[model samples]
Target: MRNAHRVEQVRAAEAELMARLPEGALMQRAAAGLAATCARLLTRRRGRVYGSRVVVLAGSGDNGGDALYAGAVLARRGARVSAVLLAPERAHAGGLAALRAAHGQVVLDQEVGLADFSRADLVLDGIVGIGGRGGLRAEAVPYARAARRGTVVAVDVPSGVDADTGEVAGVALRADVTVCFGTYKPGLLIDPGAGYAGAVQLVGIGLDLPPADVSALQHPAVAELLPEPGAESDKYRRGVVGVAAGSATYPGAALLAVAGALHGGAGAVRYVGTAAEEVVRRFPETLVTEGGPAGAGRVQAWVVGPGGGEGARQALAEALASDVPVLVDADGLTELGRLGPGALAGRTAPTLLTPHTGEAARLLAGADGGAPPPADELAAARLATARRLAAAYRATVLLKGSTTVVADPGGAARVNPTGTSWLATAGSGDVLAGLAGSLLAAGLPVLDAASVAAYLHGLAGRHAASTPGAPVTALQVAAALPAVWRQVRASATADE
Candidate 1:
């Protein structure tokens, strides 16, 4: 699992580490890692760091100090290093002295900064740290835009992004490489900020931090969570997933959802919707019935609402009434809003809600009885939005978009890392919902079920898209699941 800590948590860990270490030791560690990464990048780009032109955009904080000190290291190794001080009066005294001792040039003029930035082989962005808000300050704004040729390396985080929420308030510096110290910040993993951060590299500064509330599952972690049958397992022993989706008008939704469920380790997929004929025709293996979830025979878990059209409300209610785990998506999410949290009240089994940004807005609006925040805003602040919705509904939520974030009501969250934008195709959410619901039936915990579903769905999407990114239909993604699943298990076993 790749963990991300909030700024406050990072600060606390840094303070604790600093208290035990000698003064300047922690900074040196950070600087050393930063310089090494820069040196490697420089070598990759220009074949050598020696005689390379490097510019440091230094602000007033520790981030600026980290960049300045790193620049000094590069200067000592024969690189032509220069610092553009955004805040000359508040520059780190120690860092400045070190840079001067190493013969690195320092300048305070914005025009001179822009000139150096345009000509440099590398630009280290230290204009803003993790704690910064809004956009670049007036003085730093021009330089941020001036660097177009060389690689831009952001210190800890790219400036102007909300490190906790991943929201870009205004213009933010985009980095080709982001060197984060101690722990990964949420911003670097989640979207608008994630978009700004090209490649993220974490440097262990040895801060003893607590386990993260937010994390992204890697292949090994996901492999461990995958459901596998035991020696004594039978068809019924594995698990059964009941899908209540599709109407006569949109049977494709049911087909796509069933496709996902079929590959999700569930022993059987029971279909209950108006699209039973279409579903059965495409997937003869499915146990099809034209009825509501309440009368869907026995099922380990229920996936309610994908293109249910008019039947979504009743289907969602009936699924909620069941003792089995339930995953609500698409039209079900819309009906859920009308019923509010009361519909989920007094349920013993776990409930998972999967919503795209637009659906999430409606859910939030209905929960608060107010106008929902714009979908774009919600997308930017995905972490907080997922957490809030989870708490409001007292269920697990998988907020789907460029990044899929799963959040439990108690605050545990997982960000999916393997998705491609190619997943934005029609009926993709239906597939994801079915896969997640099947995992729930297979007895993974709600969070694990959602996280693993997202992980597989993303990988499958990537497989369907292939290299250079071609358009992928939802069925192609579903078809790719088994291969991705096999690859994941194989990789995991090979490691052992």
Candidate 2:
């Protein structure tokens, strides 16, 4: 797992580490890592660092000092380096002296800074640190709009991005690479701010920290969480997932959901809905039944909704009434929103709610009895949105979007790192819902089920859209799951 700490946690850890070290030891370690990464990037871009043009955008804090000191190292290596101070008077005095000693050019004029920023082979952005909020200062706004010819490396978190929430309220500078000190920031892992951060590289300054509230699962961590059958396992023992979805108006939803469940590590799938005939015709292996979830024989878990149409409300209620875990999605989420959080109050089993921002708005409004907030606003602050929904509903929530975030009511969260834009196609979410529900049937906790399903679903989407990169259908994404599953397991075993 890749852990991400909030801004306050990072600050506390940094301060404690600094106190134990020499006056400048910690900064030197950070600068050395920054300079090394810059050197590698420069070597890859051209042949060498010699004669390359490097520009440093320095602010008034330690962030700027880190950049200036790194620039001094590059200058000694024969790069033609220049420093543009956004706050000249408050700039780090030691960093300024070091850069000047290395014969680096210092420009205080904004026009000259803009000119250098546009054409430099590499630009180091230090205009604002993790503590800075809102957006870039007025003096630094031009750099955000300037045409650039090379890679821009942000000192830590990207300027103007919320290190704690990943919220970008105003204009923020985009970076090709961000070298964060200590641990990863939540802003660098979640979207909006994540989109601005091209590629992230972590440089540890060796700080002891507590458990992280946010994390992203890597391949190994996911591999360990996957459910595998034992020697004595039978079909029933492995677990059966019950899917209550679809209607006369949208029978395809049932087919797509079952397709995902079949390969989701569950031994069997028992489907009950109005689309039973269509599901049997497509996936004959599915155990189909008539009517609603209440009549569906035995199932370890229930996946309700997904093109349920008029039958969604009944299906959602029946699934919640069951003693097993339930996952609600699509039309089912709409029903849950109408009924509010109280709908799940009587249930003892675990519940997972998967909603895109639009549905999320409805769920929030349902909880508070107000007009739905704009989808864009909720999406901009995905971390908080997911946590809020989880708390309000008292269930695990998987907020699906540019970055899939899974949060429990207790505030522990995980962000999925795998996925492509192609996963945004129709019925993709239905497939995800079924896969996650199947995992729940197989006995993974709500959080693990949602996170693992997201990981595999994302990989499957990437595979379906690979090579020629043509548009793929929802079934193609489902078909790609088995291969990706094998790939994930194989890669994990090889690493061992």
Candidate 3:
């Protein structure tokens, strides 16, 4: 797992580590890593770092100090380095002295800084640190607009991004690569801020930290969570997932959901919906049942909603009333939103809610009986939005969009890292809902089930779109799951 710490957590850990180390040791360690990464980029772009033009945009804090000190290191290696001081008097005194000693040029003029930034072989962004929120300062705004031919590397977290929440309120500098110290920040792993961060590199400064509230599952971590049948395992022993989805108008929804369930490691799928005929035609292996979830016989878990249309409310209620875990998605989310958290208040089993931003707005509005907030606004604050919905409903939530964030009511969260823009297709969500519900039936915890399903769903989407890189149908994505599952397990085993 790739863990991410919040800004406050990072600060506390940094302070504790600094107390035991020499005054400048920690900064030096960070600077050394920053310089090394820049050096490698310089080498890759050109032949060498010697005689290359390097520009440092230095602000007022230690973020600037780290950049300035790194510039000094590059200057000593025969690179032509210039430090642009946005706050001349407030810049780190030690860093300034070090740069001057190494013969690095200091530009106090804004025009000169812009010119240097536009043509330099490399530019280091230190305009704002993790604590600097809102947006870029007036003096630093020009660099964001200025066209740059070289690579831009950000120090720690990117400027103007909330390191704790990944929210970018206004304009922020986009970096080709970000070298974060100690550990990854939450902002660096989520979107809005993550979109600005092209690629991320973790440079350990050795700060002893506590458990991270947010994390991204790697292949090995996901491989461990996946279910495998033992020799004594029978069809019932593995697990059975009951899917209640689709209607007369959207019969394809049921077929897609059942298709995903079949490949989700569930030993069997019991489908109950109006689209039973269509579902059986496509996947005859499914055990078709009449009416609602209450009469669906035995099932380890229930997946409600999808293209449920008019029957969603009853199906959701029945599934929630069951003693087993339940995953609610699509139309089911709409009904749950209308009923508010009280609808799920009596349930003892785990409940997982999957909502896109628009559906998320409805869910949030339902909690307070107010007008739904704009979908775009909710999407911009993905982490907080997911956590809020989870707390309100007292369930695990998988907020799907550009970033798929799974948040449990207790505060732990996981961000899916394998998503692609190609996943925004029709019926894609239906497939995801079934896959996650199947995992829940297979006995993964609510959080793990949601997180693992998202990870695999994203990888499957990527694989389906890989061949010609064109748009793919929902069925193609579901078909790609088995191959991707094998790939994930094989890669993990090889690493072991």
Candidate 4:
């Protein structure tokens, strides 16, 4: 799992490292790393480090300080560096002195022409740090936009992103690369912000960051979480998935969902809904049940609500009330809104909710009068959201998107790293839900199951996208699963 430290947690770690080292030691290390990165960029481009125009977007904090010191390094190497001070008075005194020593000039107000920025080969964004609040101030947004016209490198974080939440409150800076100090902040890994962050580079500031309480799935974790059957294991021992999906109007959703579960390593899949006949006609191996969850009895886990229509409402309620772990998706999430988390709270089994942004917003809106915490940004952290929901009503929450987060009811959170835009196709989510259910039924813990399933699903989608604009159907995604599974296992074995 990829460890992510919160700003405060990072601050505490920084404090520890600072206390142990000489004064300004940590910042100097940070600055040195930043300088080295700029040096590499210059070298890679086969451009002159000397006489190359370098623009620093300086702000009021340590982030700007890093840029200033890095500017000093470049100045010594022969670059004509200019610091565009966004808040001249609040600039770091030490950084300013260092720049002056290295022949770096400060550009105040709009005195530095925007044309200068256009001429620069590289722009360094030091407008904000982890301590920053909200988006880029109105004065800075225009410059950030202009910098995007050139190669932009961000120090620590790209200015204007919510470091913890990845949300863009207003205007945000885009970067060619963001050189982070110490451990990664959520902004560098989570989407929207991560997308803007470009290629991430961790600068070794040498601080011993606290082990992340919440982590995203790394490649190794994905391998460990996937299922491997024993020779003695029967189809029943491997597990079976009961799918209650699709209506007569949308039998394809049933087919897709079942297709996902086929590679789930389940001995069999029991299909129950108006689409049962269709699933039976297609797969033949899937047992078609005339009734839903109750009648589809004795399965390891249940995947409910893909194309359920009005009939979805009833299937969702039944799945929630079941003892086995359940994966709720698509229409199921809508039904969850009506039944509420209350229906699943008292149950002893695990419940997984795979909701995209819109579904997540609705879930939060419904949880209105809950206990207080920091603003929504921190709360949206997987551990905070997952546990809050887990405690509020009991269920594992797998909030899906570019950064797929799986949070257990009480402890940590796992983020899935293996996904791309290709998985955005219609019926894609149905496949994911079915796969997750199969994992849950196979007896992996909810957070691990959901996250690993997501990783595998993403790999399948990637393999299935044969060409640009080529349709990646759910069945093809399913057919691609063995390749995904083999790839992970091969990687794992190679690692050892």
Instruction: Tell me the deviation in Å of residue 32 in model 2.
Output: 0.5
In candidate 2, clashing pairs total: 0
State TM-scores per candidate: 0.99, 0.99, 0.99, 0.91
| lDDT at residue 187 of model 3 (Cα atoms) | 93
State the lDDT at 346 in candidate 1.
Answer: 99
For model 2, state the Cα shift of residue 163 in Å: 1.2
Give me the overall lDDT of model 4: 0.80
Local error of candidate 3 at residue 89 (angstroms): 1.2
Error of 2 at 347 (Å): 2.0
lDDT of 1 by residue, 1-496 (tens): 8999999999999999899999999999999999999999999999999999999999998989999999999999999999999999999888889999999999988898798899999999988999899988888788667747899999999998888878898888889999999989988889988999889999999988899998989989999999999999876788999999998778899999999999999889999999888889999999987679888898999999999889999999899999999999999999998778888999999999999999999998889888878999898789999999999999999999888899999999999999899898999999998899889889999999999999999999999999989999999999999999999999999999
* Model 2 agreement with the true structure over 1-496: per-residue lDDT tens digits: 8999987898898889889999988888999999999999999999899999999999998999999999999999999999999999999888889999999999999999999999999999988888888988899989999999989999998898888888999989999999999999999999999998889999988979899999999999888988899999987888899999888888899899999999899999999988888889899999988879999889999999999999999999989999999999999999999999999998889999999999999999999999999999999999999999999999999999999999999999999999999988989999999999899999999999999999999999999999657788899999999999988889899999
Question: Residue by residue across 1-496, what tens digits does model 4's lDDT show?
Answer: 6677889988988999899999998999999999999988977765658777888888998999999999999999998899888888999889989998999888885646466677787888998988886789987888766643557899998998777756667788888999999877787777667778998888877777767856767667778877788989887898888999998777899998998888776777888899777788889998887877887768889999898887888898887778888888878877776656676767788788887766665566556643334434533453345556555556788877667777776756676667668788888888888888888878888877888888899888888985553567778888898898898889988999
- Cα lDDT for residue 180, model 2? 96
Model 4 spans with C-alpha error above 4 angstroms: 147-149, 361-391, 466-471
Against the reference, the lDDT scores of all candidates come to 0.92, 0.94, 0.94, 0.80
Each prediction's RMSD to truth: 0.9, 0.9, 0.8, 3.3
Instruction: Give per-residue lDDT, candidate 2, residue 80.
Output: 96
